[model samples]
Target: MCEHMRPASAFWSFRENISPSALSVTTDGKHTVVGTQNGLIFLNSRGRPLWFNKKIRKVADVSVSTKSGKIAVGSSQKVLYLVNLKGEPIWHRELDSSVIAVSISSRGNLIVVGTDLGKLILFDGKGKKKWEVHLSNSDFPVNSVDITSDGEFILAGTDYSHLYLYDSNGSVLWSKETGSAVLKTCISSNGDYLGYLTSDCKFSFCVKNSRMLWENTFDSQPLWIDMAQTADFVSIGESSNKVNLYNKSGRKVWGFANESSRMGVMASGGGNVILGNKGGIFNYSLEPYLKRLLTGCKRSIIKATEENLDVTESRKIYDVASKNFSNANFSQFLINIHKARNLAREARVIESDSVPSERRLERNEVEEDPIVPQENTEDEMMAKLVQLAEMREKGILSEEEFIMAKSKLLRI
Candidate 1:
């Protein structure tokens, strides 16, 4: 992928490392809310700090209700806060254990909270408890939870590497095992796609009705995370400070790496992308043309090595010849080089063999013809042409033979 835009000069500087937690954006995209390890809530805009929570004990997760103007924050202190847009607490509730995850329905009428002990609490718009489900056995904790955009299902990730899907009526729909603990998950606006980041640093997105749509495994664990989706693409982030962009077809589009270890924020509006890290917030104009060029280059390298070229000289010839061609023509070049190289290798083997001639061919005749009979003019010329062309293409033929064969072929 091509990075056409440079990092913007705008940036937010934090006094300390951003604690491992979830980050969220308001529905209007005007403000961002993040939870800190020390139970603080921070609201930021354009690399500028807007508000900070002073009294909230270390918040573990936070989510914004797009329709109701409510912000739900969960803490390890076994408390959940329902705050308004101005960051004022509207209500507070205690869970049986430390709250690990929280998500608000799009209409803001419902709030779902997951506890470290694997219990789920559902509250109505007014903070009244509607239902609660305990998933804790002897072995797992509720790692994360997300409600579908249409309020049809509640998706939860567990510490034991499994995902449980529950209908709005609190019925289990389906469950699937992941490679590792699922760290985070996000569903698309239309409710047809779901994306998740795993503890193993692998990101996977799939259609809600089927198996995996696409997955990417990384070398480092992801920290703060968010995803942007379009009809054709999805972009994900890592706490190690990188943004991995992917196509809807499950291909990697490109990636942005941050040199600074600061937490990075990502959001998309209209067609523009906003990236925030320690350096600042930058608005990047998407460049599809340049991205195509880079993606083409990457595909060429992958296709070049897919076939076995060692069995034939043609394969070797095409492999070497294609390097000089334009990136788009590399596949054809590879084929040509392989054919030429194979032929040359066969010719060498034929010439190296020492064999006695048939009794029909006298010693004198064998000496006169060498490899081919001198009297057979057409056959001799064709043999010479093939040899000369092969050698010249391989950079082994003399200038004289190369020119002679060229003249002969042109005359014919």
Candidate 2:
């Protein structure tokens, strides 16, 4: 059996002040954008706060294009804002009805939005309206919508349970009915596949031929569907704590069902899945064919420490060390483990106690790379470990190289 590595889950690298119920999150496995009651928060890859704005309110939904750097925020007040990474709105427009759903194309040229009043509108990246239409000549608010990477095909579901595929020119390609209210829907990155869930628990997928490929019912209704650019996996975030994973052929591969009812922040990566919630974010490798890890943080203690960011996510991995220390028979190893845990907890307190000036931080802003580290910390050991893990994930450090470095750290 492969040896257990460090804990698979940790709080995102830094910062938090999120109000759980009012937050909407979206990620492309790299950058994450969060929509709150009065503002939107953007984060770099390591979860460092980059910028936020207090003007946008009641964000109904948000979308991020992985290939393109554009971010879209749809508000319930009949407006949508197209913004860049700097949190500056490129443009904002008022729609015909309250914006219920919004999506951005990969090329960042087209955006599609569904209204609560049965209207669908398409726009260019500059927030200029291209076309608008009311579905079925009546009020059947569009529920969910997605655009292909090339802006060619648009998939939208409405309150009347109708699904329509429209071309960029506002021409209908085809339409179908789910026999119940459509809850959520999404299109694959290449625009070849479309999948959706309905009010009756029906989960279905279709191919480019406009033919139904497969359909099934779920015990728990899905709240959202996520399909990333490179992976063939489709993630179904259900109302239950479960997030189900399925292949393109509609086969069940695996799932993660920990924490709350929603998989609030998600991104798929090389044979693995990353999830974030009110508690924090975690990175897990699916071992077996693809499944993984071992490190527990007595759930009650974690729940209790939820508000204490200084001790929670950032110090979580040390909980594993805590467990290991208790059973260790060697005195020297136990001393080191105890010392390491203390240092880790101290690191958390130091991190949480400090705040960066938003204006001053812009000078450190990365215009071209979001994932690069901008600063260093006082803890060299932890910093080195984080660097090693990043290198391993990026394939800069081989498994053997990582194991060698990790073993040395554990010895300390």
Measured against the true structure, the TM-scores of the candidates, in listed sequence, are: 0.61, 0.63
Worst 10 residues of 2 by lDDT: 359-368
Candidate 2 Cα lDDT to native: 0.60
- What is the Cα-based lDDT of residue 284 in candidate 1? 35
Q: For each candidate, how many residue pairs have backbone atoms clashing (under 3 Å)?
A: 23, 6
Kindly list the per-residue Cα lDDT of model 1 for residues 191-236, writing each as its tens digit: 5567777888888766665356556676677654444432234556
In terms of TM-score, the best-performing candidate is 2
Residue-by-residue lDDT tens digits, candidate 2, 363-397: 11221112223333323344345444544564645
RMSD of 2: 18.8
Candidate maximizing lDDT: 2
lDDT of 1 at 18: 50
